[model samples]
Target: MGKLAQLSGPVGLLLTAALTGTVGFLPQPAAAQSLLQQEGTLAPMQDTYSFEGEADQTLTITLTSSEFDPVLSLLDPDGEEIARNDDYASVLDSTIIITLPETGSYTVVATSFSGEGGSYAVEVHPTTEYEQVFDRAVQLFNSEDYTDSVEAFTAAIALDDSQPSVYLGRANAYLGAAYLALGENFAGPQSLEPEVRDAIATDYEQAAALLKEQGKPDLAASLEEQAQIFRLVEPEPAPLRPAEPPEEPANSQS
Candidate 1:
């Protein structure tokens, strides 16, 4: 018998219940997409969702299942597997992002890695203006124009709050601007302007939380450490001035 058969009856029942709980927490398509959400129980072992695609257009497909490890695969019009992903950002759920090679109908398959399927939800969204703005923000960051980069990233976030990666980029911009404003001695928080340092720490904290939620635990931990460093920076002590040379006896002579 397989491992499933070795499990105690109660343990097996608990496993089944855990999978059942995931069905209620599946995410629907974002309102920004204005598309109808697609949801269904896996047909025994697999389910396929079909949608039209356009050349050069970016597409995002997400699959979530409560009972099994979801596997997502994309197939082109000719039924060739274009790309596939098992987990998105280390999360149990699966997400696939791609730029269509040609205009045609594409197939997205939702299935389990172990062939144990259950309730699942799938959503497809096309590239929007938010993507364009995000690209621009990235360009500004690369150009080292940290101030403008922060503004551009903020704009992108306003456009799509659902995207957690944007928070990471914005946090970087904030850190960059803080250091640039210092011009020198940016290593320690003591050398930084109080307001600037505070902003940097705040952004880092926000990024850490968002990254954790996005299933990037390692990155989140790193950012949290950086934030703590700034928060713990002690004010530098004032440099002591050399005592003035003893005044000449001219005062007594006068």
Candidate 2:
């Protein structure tokens, strides 16, 4: 399977629909508008729409349906999968927040995860600065570029400090960086600098507080526990190198 098929939940269905000439295309909409809304039926097939997008433009695309579980994917002008979402949060709906890398006509794909037919609504809108930064940070995190991810998440926090998820993201980035610094197999947290270690704990604490304020006590408690454990963990000792073999003893006989 191609990368698009792997990342996009139902691209196989999309391909089948395409091969059978069953795929449907929605009306092309102007991308300059602040908001674009489309209502369509999946009918056990995928629906595609095209709109112009600009470089560095951040957009939040949401797919919602009461009839079936929705999956959404965005493709660049080159038909590369830019972003795909099977679910947002813990719900069946889907949302993709992405920053366009270049200007071109982008395609939006809407389909059902389970091959069930249903009416769905797709919305495209430019995201706020904070969301764009947060989305980039998340992309960085997923790519394992923890250092840049940390910076991006920090920028996001500066823009909107009230979001628990931002704090959580930064904490994860910090932890990832710590692991990278100490070597992936280094156990515990001993080798980590005090400042970096403390930063990780602090971000988790902050996230927990924010989640508590949001009335999500269970999630808040989990973060709190993680912070406590992280603070107490110790790094494992580095492996000892094997001693060099004794130098040849015998030249003396001569």
Candidate 3:
């Protein structure tokens, strides 16, 4: 049995739903679906977001799910795994620390290597001398506070463009802002502004191209994956609930 198998029911369901891909939930015409779910639930929760951290500092991570053993990893700007653990042994209920290189944005992937069970809380970006602007942008995105994330990301990019990763990070922030407004005003998912999505895709592509030019294939691939993050959030049918009172019909002219 996988490490997550020992987890209880409520926690297992939460983690399973978080990690599993949208495609995995629906039925397929040709093949049977795998029993495993891919994503884990965050304690508060957000699918994509950012945090701040100092350069070359150990960032702490915590796990809290009933179903899975959380493996926290920090991917460097060049897209290399600076830290990981397939053998984290015990300390299952405690915190773990990992460090990042340089002062820039890094993708912190919290995955359940075992099965479907685990919830996690991570504290990376420090509020010290070296503030985490990128992380701040992500927090804004998480809270649907788009205007600030956009401004923060823009400010970050303006300060430094030497790093291709920063461009991609800010691009995502901008996209999130646009998406937030689009979601609020529009009637359905189909109403997402195509121009905005295209802008995001294009910007992300540029970031990936820059990475490729720098000869960082791994980082480039991760950037490409990020380009698809928003592409797959399928909407579920409305849930059953008590009916609301009907609105009054307009009166006919005399």
Candidate 4:
């Protein structure tokens, strides 16, 4: 949501239902909407899916009856995890939310945490308005258009303020710009200036705020720790050069 938690009421309910697997009222509709593990639907001991996620995509996961160490993971074509969650509560299956960064095959793995048994539901689809903004932001970042890239990312976050990764990307961009500012001055062991230090701090702060909003306090704190460490040490001083004395006033006033 390039507008932040401003999603339509229905959309919010749909998302919550997908996340918690708590189907009620419109049982038929909910069952029809559930992509992964609808009741009675056979979920292969292992299940996988792929999608075109160039921009903003909403990938929903649902768990029916999970056991200890229940497993859920998403993989790119390169077999990299763009996002994943494997945690469980009281040996019950739990839905996890993850987003894709690029287009590729995504694998969703579900297994018992205790090496015994488990089941889950999953949904992978595009978040159009969200993806549009995300893609444009990525385009800007790759093109080295820092300001616009940041603006686009900001727009996306504003819509779904619950995403931690959005803030992470934006914060990284700000940190990159801050580091790039050193230029020729970038050489010193202590090369960073005070302004640069402050920029880094701000970047961490913004990112942490986003993570916190997403119900991830630990992650936010870790970023804060990172921001603090770099500020303590001063950058290396610039090298000094010898100076020559001024020449005698050109043969003084004739």
Off by over 4 Å in 3: 1-131, 184-198, 217-254
Candidate order, TM-score descending: 2, 1, 4, 3
Better of 3 and 4 by lDDT: 4
User: lDDT tens string, model 1, 168-204?
Assistant: 5676677677778767767766676767667767776
Best by TM-score: 2
Model 3, 56: alpha-carbon shift in Å?
A: 17
**For model 3, where is the 10-residue window of minimal lDDT?**
21-30
Question: What digit string (tens of lDDT, one per residue) describes model 2 on residues 1-254?
Answer: 11111121211100000001111111111222344566777788888877777899877777777788889999999999979998553346777887899998888889889899888777676776766777788779878999999999899878878776677778778877888877866586566677877887898789778767767676677777777766875445799999999898776764
RMSD of 4: 17.8
| Count of steric clashes across candidates, in order | 0, 2, 14, 18
After superposition, the stretches of candidate 4 with alpha carbons farther than 4 Å from their true spots are 1-122, 180-184, 187-196, 213-215, 230-254
lDDT of 1: 0.64
lDDT of each: 0.64, 0.69, 0.46, 0.48
For candidate 2, the clash count comes to 2
What is every candidate's alpha-carbon RMSD to the true fold? 15.3, 16.4, 17.9, 17.8
TM-score of 2: 0.57
Pairs in clash, predicted candidate 1: none
